[model samples]
Every structure is written in structure tokens, then in C-alpha cells.
Target: MAFTETTARLTDQGVMAMLTSAVQAAGASGQPQCIVIVDGSGVVLASFRMTGSRYLSLKSATAKARTAASIGAPTHTLPDHAKAALAAATGGDVTGLKGGLPIRSGGVLLGGIGVGSGSGEQDETVARAALAAIGADDI
Candidate 1:
């Protein structure tokens, strides 16, 4: 038997930049959000909760990140059927929320980021800001 595999991954610096940018975006919008980053394997790499954010948002943020990383697509962009099926398959471990976005670089899947605590659109805005910070917003 032989096994060989390669995968893209986010560096620690990338995580920091992402979190910082997302937080700033949320603050500018007058919202407190919980931000989370997950690796390609759906394991959390980093996370942050703003001082005024609701505690439940932490779980929502993590689920969003895991959904994006596991499905390799932005949560909000998934087709309706696909989102339903994925949610059922994951038994709610994944969420099809607008705040989740896959992180890619050079056409390679690296990880995902998620933000919560505000409306879906607000959360997505913060996530996009984080992606833009690293020039990964094209994905």
C-alpha cells in the first residue's frame, strides 16, 4: 500500500491577519462579532469573540467555518438542495450561513473563516474584509 497526499493550509500569520481585519470591520459597522477560522480539515485554527458579542455566536461562527472548509465553498453560495443535504449529512455540524467563506489561494483550498453576532449580511461583510486583507477575496 502507498499513500501520498498534499493539501493547502493557512499559516499562523494568515490567521492573525484575518482575525484582525474581521474585527476591525465589525467594529466599524458598530457590531460586535465572533470570528472563527478552520483548517481544511474543519479543525479550528484560531478564533476571537468581541467584548459585546453574544456567547452563542461562538458556536455559530465555528459551525460556519467548518461548513465552508468541509464543503470547499462559501456557505451562502451553496445551492438550496446542496445546503440541505450537507446540513443533514453533517447532522447540524455544518451551517449554510452567509457568514462562512472558504479561504483559497492560487486555486488551492486552504481553510475558511466565519463571523457571527450580527445579521447575516453584516457577518458576511466582516468575513469578506478578512479575506480581502490577505488578497484571497477572489475565491
Candidate 2:
């Protein structure tokens, strides 16, 4: 697989618009949030941190996005799908912690989105809303 640099790299503006819409929705709920999007190689594509969002939210969201993109699995699917082989292969860093989801388009994996802030359930809700806004299927 080839690695692509996402720092200042171009991406689909429509996807970004969808992500921002989701973040705004979460904020409208009166909660701060950290949102991160990663490409298939686990490269940070886009990131946003709402005002008053917890500092730790940045790292947590990054972890969730990376986990999903690296494994082609949703973070919520981890606990039940824990396999020794996967752990060993991933060096034991996979977290099925409930707010990470892969972004799929037309059956093709585009990237992954992870959200943190508020709470775990809230994070998932925000991310799911973003994906829905883009009509992206979750992996």
C-alpha cells in the first residue's frame, strides 16, 4: 500500500462539509467535542476541536480514527471481535471503544472518523450523525 500525506493535502470538500455539519450539530447539543478523520493509512486528514473541548479529547479521537482505519473495523466492534491474532498483528493497540467508525463510499473504504468529548455514547452519536450526513456507510 502507498502512503499519502494528508497535511494540507486536498480532499473531497463535500466530505469536509459533512464533517463540519456534524461537529456543529454536536456543539448545538451544548457539548464540546474533538473530531478527527484519518485516511486508510492512518494519516490525519482533517481535525477539529470545539472550544472548551477537553484536552485529552484530541488524543482519544486520534486513537479511535487510527484504530478504525488501520483495522477496517469500527471501534464499537472491538470487544466482541477480539482475536489474539489481530492483537499480535496490531501490537496490541486496537481499541473497540465505541466511537470509531470507518467511512465507506460506494462499498469502498474512504477513511475513518472518530469523535471524542461529552461522553463515549455522545461521541458515537456525533460521529454517526456526521457519517449519515455524508450518506457514508459505517464499517
Candidate 3:
């Protein structure tokens, strides 16, 4: 008898499929967007932004993805908790913004995704789509 151990990855094709869907959805609402995907160590693996996407979205998306990776929690969850924990630390980098999500496959932390340029809710929708395309569990 033998047991097989499979490897997992956040493939470029998969990531693209997800981002494209998000872009389509966001664009439908006439909103440009920036999307980011990073590994567990806060390394960026993929990113894209529509021409009209707000310039700030690039940095925000990157930051959100990094935060999710570094904190090992969903982007949506950390902000409120960070607020209580940081209190005075709110102004700088770690703002309680949404649209970041960690990528986990078979209980392993693969990476994370972040979106911006639209409303927080819209950004989150994009992130969820990306996660799904990459075959990850949990939002």
C-alpha cells in the first residue's frame, strides 16, 4: 500500500481566470480595480489594475495582501482586531480595510489575494473570485 502526497500551487492561469472575472464584474459597474496576489511570506506573485483604476488601489491592494499573509488571518477580520490592539497605531500602514484573503490548500498557507479601487465590498468580491479560481478553501 502507498499514500500519495500532492503538491499545490497558485498557478498563473488560475489566477488570471479569477482576476479576469473580477475585472469583468467590476467593470460592469463602471469601476476600475487593482488586484494583488501574494505568497505566505508577503511576496507578490501576481497583480493587475485597469487603466482607470485609482492609483491608490495598487498600494492598498498590495498592503492588504501582505497583511493577510503576515497576520495569517482573513483581511476582513484583522482590521477590527487590529484597531483594538493597535489603537494609536491605526494611522500608519495597517489600516482596518477589507479585500484581502489568505490562500489555503489542504491546510497549507499558499498565498493571499487583495483587491482595491472599488468599494470595500467590491474588492472583497474580487478576492473571493480569485481564491475560488485558485482552488482554495475558506474566504
lDDT of 1 by residue, 3-90 (tens): 9877667888989999999999999999999999999888899999999999999998998998888788888887877877877887
Summarize candidate 3's per-residue lDDT along 21-59 as a digit string, tens digits: 767777877878898888777778888888899988898
- TM-scores of all models? 0.89, 0.78, 0.79
- Residue-level lDDT of model 2, residues 84-130, one tens digit each, is 45556766455666688887777767778888877778888888887
Greater-lDDT candidate between 1 and 3? 1
Model 1: which residue pairs collide? none
Regions of candidate 1 where Cα sits further than 4 Å from its true position: 1-6, 81-89
What ranking of all candidate models by TM-score puts the best one first?
Answer: 1, 3, 2
Worst 10 residues of 3 by lDDT: 87-96
Clash count in backbone of candidate 1: 0
Distance from true location, Cα of 66 in model 2, Å = 1.0
List per-prediction Cα lDDT, in the order shown. 0.89, 0.76, 0.76
**Candidate with maximal lDDT:** 1
